[model samples]
Target: MRKVLITGAAGFLGSHLCDRFIKEGFHVIGMDNLITGDIKNIEHLFKLKQFEFYNHDVTKFVHVPGKLDYILHFASPASPIDYLKIPIQTLKVGSLGTHNLLGLAKEKGSRILIASTSEVYGDPLVHPQSEEYYGNVNTIGPRGVYDEAKRFQESITMAYHTYHGLDTRIARIFNTYGPRMRLNDGRVVPAFIGQALRGENLTIFGNGLQTRSFCYIDDQVEGIYKLLFSDYVYPVNIGNPDEITIKEFAEEVVRLTGTDQKVIYKPLPTDDPLQRQPDISKAKEILGWEPKIGRSEGMKLTLDYFKAFSKEELRKSEHRDFV
Candidate 1:
């Protein structure tokens, strides 16, 4: 069986990747620090002899025995709430963590994929962001910790690819939503659903006009899977291009949950992107990948998953202890 090392294997995206690889008959070595990742996301694979896990921080060093065919570097605090609370750790994961993985990949002659984000576009000046568009970013902003981390991650990955002749792929992931997402992660989808389920009003920031394009988790995983195998070395945007405003999405959530929750507005967080939509031309042209799941279909599945949470679970997840 082909062996692969997946960092952040317990995260929403990473867990799904683990499942996909396991399905494809790969011996998967999963690693995470459990800082923002929940082991529960990948606990199902514990029974499988092919799935091995390590509860270690990638920022220090990464050592995996045997041959590694691929390495997916997905270890980083991905959300605003998590990164803001632990800025240094977030930076280290993207920079130092990524560096360690690149070295490991070099040593093992493994193909490595780095998880880049749309946030690298940074409140993008371009509508429907394409991979070529250099982003307009506030380096000193609160959100820079996460954004810059991703940017640096991409740069280093490319450097290794050119300098060391490492096989590398970079997926510029956009906003994705689905099962296993943390309610209190402060991302829009889970936050809205959590509020509605808790009988609380859904909160909107920045006048609700700020737009985002949400890709479903399954589609996202598929895109990443395809990218990993494809020979493309540059970044490819993996996200649904269907864009919606924050206010409109809140209404959709209320309808989906069959709740009579009100929508409340709050000040927009600093450096929040007003518009985010991916131009997936490269993904389509190269990997022949585009999101097959529409928002309605995807949202229903996601909502159903969150609806399974007990009231106590919902209550406790109402606020994440950032500390």
Candidate 2:
């Protein structure tokens, strides 16, 4: 069987990728530092002989026992709350961690895929961002930590592809929501769901006018998987183009959850993107991939997953001190 090493293997996206790879009959090596990752997301895979787990930080040297067919670097702290709390670590992982992984991929002659984000298009000046658009990013802003980290990740991956002739792929992921998402991760999906479940008003920042296109987890994974196997070397946007205003999304959540809570407004955080919608032309043209799940269908599945959490778990995740 082909072997793959997935960093951040315990994360929401990484764990799902592990499941997908395992289903494809690959020997999977899962690695994570457990800093922001919950081991429960992947504990179910422990029984499989094809799956192995490593509790190690990728910012240091990354080593595998034998040949690796592929490597997916998904180890960085992805959410706003976690990255804001640990900004330096976020930068290091995107820079140092990515460098380490690229070196390992070279040594093993393995194809590597880097998880870039839509945040690289900081408060994008272009509508429905495409692959060729250069983003307007704030290097000194609060959100810059995550944005710059991802931007650097893409740059280095491309460099490795060109310089070392290393096989590499970059997926510029957009707002994705589904099961295994941390309820208190300071992302809109979980925050709104957690509030509605607790009967609290859904909080919206910046007048709820900011728009975001959310892709379901399954669709996002499928896009990434296709991109990994495709021959595209440049960055590809993997997200649903179905855009919705924050206000509209919150209302949708209310209706979906059958909640009576009202919407509350708060000051929009600094450097928060006012609009986010990916132009997935390349994804469709090249990978022949587009989101198969609609919001209503996807949201219901996500709600069902969150609904399974105990009341105490919901209460604990309902509030997080982002500062």
Candidate 3:
């Protein structure tokens, strides 16, 4: 069986990747520091004969016991709430942690894929961001920690690819939501859903005009998988291009949850992107991929998952980094 090691294997995205790879008959080794990642996201896989886990922080060093065919470095504090609270750790994981993983891939001769985010395009001057667009990022802003770290990550990955000839893939993921997402991750999705569940008004920042394109988790996973296996070594925007404003998206969540609550407005966070939509021409042309799951269908599955959370969890104002 082919062997693959996945970092952040307890995160929403990483755990799903584990399930996908294991289904494809690979011996999947999972690793996470349990900082922002909850083991519950992956506890089900602990008993599988094909699965093994490491509870080490990738920022230090990563050592897998056996030969590996692939490495998916999905281990970072992805959400704003998590990254802002632990900014240094976020920077380290993206910079030092990525460096460590790249070294590991070199030693094992493994193909490595790093998870890059749309935040790298921070408060974009472009409408729909494509791979070639140089981003307009605020290096001194509060949100810069996450954005710059990823930018540095992409830089180093490309350097390794160009200089040392490493087999690398970078997936510039856009906003994605689904099962296993933390209720208080401070993204629009869970915040709206939790408010609807707990009988509170959904809060929108900046007049609810700021837009985002949300890719369903399954579609995001499929696109990442396709990118990993494809020969394309450059970055690919792997997300749904279906864009919606914050106001409309909140309404959808309320409608799906059968809630009567209204939406309340708040001040927008500093450096928050006004618009985020991916131009996935490369994803379509190269990987032959575009998102298949629509928001309505995806929201129902996500709603069911959030509904399963214990009542205690639902009552909390925010659940990030407190687990």
- Regions more than 4 Å wrong, model 1: 320-323
lDDT of each: 0.94, 0.94, 0.92
Quote the positional error of residue 91 for candidate 3 in Å.
Answer: 0.5
How high is the lDDT of residue 260 in model 2? 93
Superposition TM-score, candidate 1 onto the true structure: 0.98
Give TM per candidate: 0.98, 0.99, 0.97
Worst 10 residues of 3 by lDDT: 314-323
Task: Compose the digit string of candidate 1's lDDT tens values, residues 1-323.
Answer: 99999999999999999999999999999999999999999999999999999999999978888899999999999988899989999999999999999999999999999999999999898888999998988988999998999999999999999999999999999999999999999999999999999999888886999899999999999999999999999999999999999989999999999999999877788888899999999999999999999999999999999989999999999963221
Q: lDDT tens string, model 2, 1-323?
A: 99999999999999999999999999999999999998999999999999999999999998898889999999999998999999999999999999999999999999999999998989899999998998999999998988999999999999999999999999999999999999999899999999999888888888888999999999999999999999999999999999999999999999999989999787888888999999999999999999999999999999999999899999899764321
Provide the lowest-lDDT 10-residue window in model 2. 314-323
